[model samples]
Target: MEIAIGVVVGAILAIAGFILGRSSGRSVGLSEGPLAGSPETDDHAALEDRSSSRESELNTVLVEAIGRVSAFLKTNVRKPLIEAGEAAGADELRERIEHALGALSDIDFFLEEPSMSRSGQSLVSLVENVAQEFSGDQDVRLRMQLASSPVRAVVSGPVMMDVLYLILHNASRFGGDSTIDIAVQAIDGRSLILVRDHGPGFSDEALQRAFDPFYSTSAEGLGLGLPHARSLIEQMGGQIELRNVSDGGAEVEVSFPSS
Candidate 1:
């Protein structure tokens, strides 16, 4: 299954590159159908139109591929790996695999273009469910300050769960052995989820490019967590912010369109 996944992902990546090559006005010498002629032969307007369409298609491919692949790894690979750690070396290997699996989530977010549809899930309940996973299966201690009132957001429940997972995952991974703090608030027209971690906090450079793809402070990661989170949130008609708290640690606030 792993080998099959690799081959499939590799082929999709190659196709994405081919589409990218065409979109960027560099042909890979494919002499077939719409890809036969060089850009110079086409009128300026037609070239722009075709390139735009190809780019859109490429984004769709990326979003679909990453989502499906990530889901498969989570169920088939990550769960077993997490459950079978009997040695220090095995733990290290599991950590590395987690980082790779995490990259897929980030890439999926970066490629997602439009806002996700609301699945009519209660915001408070959805967050609590995700929090339970973190505290139980992941063994990450969490302190929750949930809202007294139930709120509904205009966002997809599954995607929002992924977003919350990435946020909490980053907090736990970087926050060392400290307990992460979480809060949900509904105020005015927005519903917010705030997560704080008692880590060393972001360096000056991290604060600047924390949302840039493939930018990671740790060597084990591809650094797509925050970038993907931010991109995915923004695309969902929500806003994500990162900052260092006054005393210590990092704080992330994600606000969604709420009723």
Candidate 2:
């Protein structure tokens, strides 16, 4: 009996020592494990990705907004201001100055407000605002055929209008007849706006690089219109396409998925 009791106690001590040794070794192994470095590495990578995404977003907004304001100044303000001075008509000059002030106020609003943020707005209203942009241009005739009812979409209203304006502006620039045709329709759960210009059709290279930033065929342009327009549209989960119509001009189609 004494021998048997001694044997049992020795076995228990041996088992306890083995368990304690394994526990100590396992604790050390966990700290030195292959996956121990993963958490920190993954965290660093995630931070980098977020930073890159934010930088890209800011760059897109900066480029597009600056381009938009520059074009507005050139087309709507500069020439008018010069002409108002040369003509020396008080009433006309006052009107032009007032218009310039209003446009400047709009620029301030665009910069201060979240004009590029997404929201639900009437697609028809957006298109109308784009058409209004050409109201002062005598040579550019703007026409729109919108749906009988209001077509709703989820997008940034200001950004969408700007994009449409850019497309229309480009069309007028290239279109030979100085006439712009805009059509809006809702089909297959999407809102589609088509801007047609009777200008010379795009060449193969132009078609391929229509959305390439800073690529312009004309000497008089900054070439950021289509690229900015495309970026805004794509950010809103929409699409913009440039194609030549068989009727001898180019057509730009803007489509946004309806809410």
Candidate 3:
């Protein structure tokens, strides 16, 4: 039991370390950095490539092992513990366990390299649906500036909607009762989803660590929302940008290929 607990803890730490050490984004479609004629630079590049490869291999193994552990914990440990807690009226224990499980879910999403295949979906409809879903889930209002022409984006609609929903959810969570402004536009062969929140725009530190896992401006945040959102978007040939709107708000713009 000691060894089993140790392994589980180790695996969880491994996942945390992997994310905290994350640099250079995902391992796909990245351009080589700063090539020069110097032999020293070439040597450094070779070492970096090998290190990067090794890290990727470690991540794969860690996820497979941690996934099994997570499943077992959920079924054998988490459920029983939660039930016992409820029966004993150990509300604090149950809440702590539940919070850990929730953190694990976010970490799993943040760590995985998603392979999202795209199909042409109407960007406009997805936005509308996501807006509706958000409003239904919470007492938040979403205002839209949809394109005049129907824009078809080469992306999975469901995944995109989830990503959009997450963006809105974050806005609503932090932006208080202010209305969220979302704009869908097609520009330069790209489909853009712009989410702007009328909150205290990101601080300099927040902007700097915008997508870093486990970094959050809110005391209540576990902080993987934007990082996971970026991973999903990047996998599907999309990109997310963070900026402060000059007019006292935060803006997140996601772009994808327009079909």
Give candidate 1 misplaced runs (Cα > 4 Å). 1-115
For all predicted structures, in order, the TM-scores are: 0.62, 0.58, 0.64
lDDT tens string, model 3, 1-259? 4544654676578555765456444444335655577556776677678768877866775565456556655664556555554346567676666755664555454445555767899989999998888888788778899999978878887788879887898888877556999999999988898999898888899889868655676544546578778878887888999999887889999998889
Off by over 4 Å in 2: 1-114
Model 3 whole-model lDDT (C-alpha atoms): 0.74
User: Could you give candidate 2's per-residue lDDT for residues 114-186 as a string of tens digits?
Assistant: 4568888888888887687666754688878999976788898877877777788788887878788899998
Ranking by TM-score: 3, 1, 2
| Collision pairs in model 2 | 175-199, 176-199
RMSD to the true structure for each prediction, in A, is: 8.8, 23.0, 8.4
Error of 1 at 80 (Å): 14
> Per-residue lDDT of 1-259 in model 1, one digit per residue for the tens?
4654654466457546644665564433333334446575465446556656776767885665455555555654556556655664866776767765665554444444554776556878888999987677687788999889887777878788878998999999998755999999988888899999998888899889787545567654546678677867887788999889999999999998786
Q: Counting only residues 3 or more apart in sequence or on different chains, how many pairs clash (N, Cα, C under 3 Å) in candidate 2?
A: 2
For model 3, the superposed segments whose C-alpha errors exceed 4 Å read 1-17, 20-115
Compared with the true structure, all predictions reach lDDT values of 0.72, 0.70, 0.74
Q: How big is the positional error of residue 91 in model 2, measured in Å on the Cα after superposition?
A: 13
Worst 10-residue lDDT window for candidate 3 reads: 22-31
On lDDT, the leading prediction is 3
Given candidate 3, what's the lDDT at residue 34? 51
